[model samples]
Target: MWDTEHNNGVLIYLLVPEHAIEIVADRGLARCVAPGEWQALVSQLAVHLREGRYEEGLAQAVDAVSARQAAHFPRRGAGTAYANELPDAPAVR
Candidate 1:
């Protein structure tokens, strides 16, 4: 699982374990994870685990990270393919 915050697209990798969860945040090429954030992430993870929806939780976390990345990276015209072969290509463009 990964949680990202800020423009630089910080990526936080989470390792969910039975007893405890491990989290590591990567800021671009650097690492800048705080203890508090780790704790909060762990708490969220625990909730997910207890709910018996680890995959859903992981998907949510990944989406969070992707949202942050998109906000920071801001890909332009990166939606669908440009070729007319694509269904509803005009609509996409």
Candidate 2:
């Protein structure tokens, strides 16, 4: 996140066994999205997790966050590819 030029970054951290979710956003993205929105997203994500819909919940969470990002920090030009700064695969500690 510190190395990114755009100053916009978001992370959705999940601890499935603990039933915990953390939505983290860098300063640029945080400026536009409200904490209430994050709270609501987390609540909805929790419901999906409790229902054993892991794939669905994750997809929904990504989609929801992506939509917000798109609205706030849209790309300047059409068809401009954004480099994958972070790995797409899940990482475990």
Model 1, global lDDT: 0.50
Measured on C-alpha atoms, candidate 2 has an lDDT of 0.85
Give the per-residue lDDT digits (tens) of candidate 1, residues 1-93: 123333143333444443555544455412333467556656776688789988876666656544644554564685843222213211211
- Pairs clashing within candidate 2: none
* Residue 39 displacement (Å), model 1: 5.7
Model 2: worst 10 consecutive residues (lDDT sum): 1-10
TM-score of decoy 2: 0.90
| Residue pairs whose backbone atoms clash in candidate 1 | none
lDDT of 2 at 91: 80
Which residues of candidate 2, in runs, are more than 4 Å off? none
TM-score of 1: 0.47
